[model samples]
Target: MKKFTQYVFCITILLSCKKIGTPELQPINLKISTVYASTELGKKLSLSKVLIKILNVNTNVEKQLITDANGNVSFQGISAGVYDISATITIPAATYSSVTGEIVDKDVIFNASDKNKTIGLTNNELNIKLVSGNIGNWLIKQIYYAGSNTTTGAGYRDQFIEIYNNTDSVMYADSLYFAEIIGRQSYTNTSYYTLPNGQMDWSKSLNMPSNIDANNNYVYPRALFMLPGKGKEHPVLPGASIVIAQTAINHKSPFTGTDGKTITVRDPSLTIDLSGADFEAYYAPFLPRPLTSDIDNPSIPNLNVLAYNGTDMLFDNPGRTAFIIFKRDGTEVKDYPKYNYPTISTPSSTSDKFYQIPNSVIIDAVEIQPNTASDRVPKKLGASLDAGYTFAPNGQYSSQSVIRKTDRTENGRKILKDTNNSTEDFDYFSLANPRGFK
Candidate 1:
């Protein structure tokens, strides 16, 4: 009977231990502090009411909180795990202009992010520095790189880019230069020059200036074109946009090609009518024999082809490309130095050269990659220019385009979102829209 009693006691102890299991994980009390960038104007700006987002990396759970007047927020009793914290705030244009003495017609966005942060017993505090982005008057509203069906649709010939004036005043398109930023297109590591992040290292190029930063301060352009206008010539009204087309012809309707043959699309719905495009890229004058569809539009003005690549202004249909628009401050683009690729061995004297553009003059930029993550190459632009890249989910020849999201409407003026993070600011359109908003 004593043995039976002891067995029951032992079973009871085992069950109690099982119920207790391991001691519950101790939750952490995390504190986050937000600060402005290290600038005179930034120091004077207020940091209160900034939205803070904390994403638990392990659990895939997210929480949001607003910062106090002192720019501090505390997360009490939170699970101890890795997290990604981000802060975003928008400053009114009047407030920014008054503080900085800079004229801005639209609101300014500031963003800060700290990734892979751990909240444990020893580490429970984090500080995020918010950096202001370009108080953009013009923005790349849409990019239609992915064309429609190759056999039944317009293919790559319908690709175009739309730029919008996001301000409330008139803005000139005069002498505005846009280019296709060049970078490593594949992931294959080569003995040739490469940046630590797997991008092409232009500093190793022959005759590259030793005085200036070749990779960080400047970007190389595979193709460069500029709008032909004097100051105040092409005035884009508030909320208006300008579309630049590869061919300014109506793809929905049959058109006469440069080859004197008719060009038509089997699926008109898959394409867009670019006949109303403000500017068209005419490469026939520069190329010995341009594409048969590269016909000139007498009604549409042509972009000044400062540099040429391929046969036309053809974008990589699978994404794997980037674009930037900037205005000349003092120096002429023609005077800018060009250099060959950074080859292990010296390139030939007649090797092709690409023009280098300074980042200081860049007004806006967008980085793109293939729809699938496996096919994506290393990012070309830095975080300041574009924190994250965007892509069309349907991949190439899918008639898709990435368009900027509308943040809010102020007095009937549409303000597009510009967080410097394309992944969050952009959404893909199943069919490309020239002046459409999401």
Candidate 2:
């Protein structure tokens, strides 16, 4: 019994002597700041927003804090450790191309204290340069599908940006860098092919015996050519920039080719006649049936435009005027006259069918007298009719008789009239140009 009592006493003593430890919490305080580009004496750099990233080395966790408009940021109650803090300054879009673009990137490090205190960092601005003017020449022509029209067609579309020797004389190909800017990266597609040494093959530069207007010297000029439907070809989205070299604008030509300074890169802004030459586009309009549908689905009647880029594409919707033809059954219809323009209506949406007009039919011309004061051309071309519509009987549709005067800014940055309406009540149709270059 005495031995049992002694064992219980030892156990009690052991329990009473137990030790518990409390962890010591060390609170941390940090402050971060950023600077912008400056050029004046003691000029303080400003930032739209600043971000500070504090990293804890032991746990490998990060804590982020954002600065106010005054370029001040702070972090509190942080875990105590040797933290590495970096600052980032953000520039707004309006200032992005202006002042912020000129700034270069700079980084700085800071340490947080165990107590609250003001910590300032400097020169955390990112270096950038503003691209004020246009960079390159090569303007993209048509990016179309090799076969049919589908969103996937964008992937299969053969892309080409036609480079113009806007400069009178021919330039060297070696001095130029032809490329597409996709995001932050620039892609180059320069060829060693001698460009515009003024040489041409017989079949390449030959003009038809009867037609003199379509005759040209070069065959495939210094244009960026890519095979459509090929895996991972040139892919472009809206607002993508295409660049060309101003110095190396010209290319070399093979032997016996015309080295004359007569090579002209066609401007897509001009009116390309379907019957005239300079039309080389790859299209497969006729596909075997059992396919899903044509280029557009759920198309609207009296509407025929594929894409709109402020007149960049043939179907530019200045006011979202771009439309596709649709039957009453919600299917796309591509028949001529099924979709045109200058459609008629009763000012109400209930009207079933209205007469329409095409957007490209030419009407008349007015002669202007020669005047030294004005550098105007001798004649001004008029539209076939205006852009309004007229009412007609049930069987007879309204005709686009008057000219529709709508302003359009062409590739040349010139405002041209959308002159195609004649009677305002006629059949609507898309322009029948195979190559969508013009």
For candidate 2, lDDT tens digit of each residue in 1-438? Answer: 999999999998776655321122445455554443234311433443455555553454778877687656667766555443444333433544354345323222111111111122332222221111111222222211111122211111111222222222333222122211100000121211111211111122212223321112111111111222233233332222222111111111111212233322232221122222121222113223311211211121111222112111221111111111111222221222211111222123442221221212111111111111121111111111121111111111111011112133335432222212211112221221222222
Candidate that scores best on lDDT: 1
Q: What is the lDDT of candidate 1?
A: 0.85
Tens digits of per-residue lDDT, candidate 1, 62-167, equal 8889999988999888888877577888889899898888888777888776654667878889887887667567899899999889988999999999999988
Cα-based lDDT for every prediction = 0.85, 0.24
Segments of candidate 1 deviating more than 4 angstroms: 1-108, 112-130, 189-191
- Candidate 1 shows a clash count of 0
lDDT of 2 at 154: 19
Candidate RMSDs in order? 6.8, 28.3
Q: Which 10 consecutive positions of candidate 2 have the poorest summed lDDT?
A: 178-187
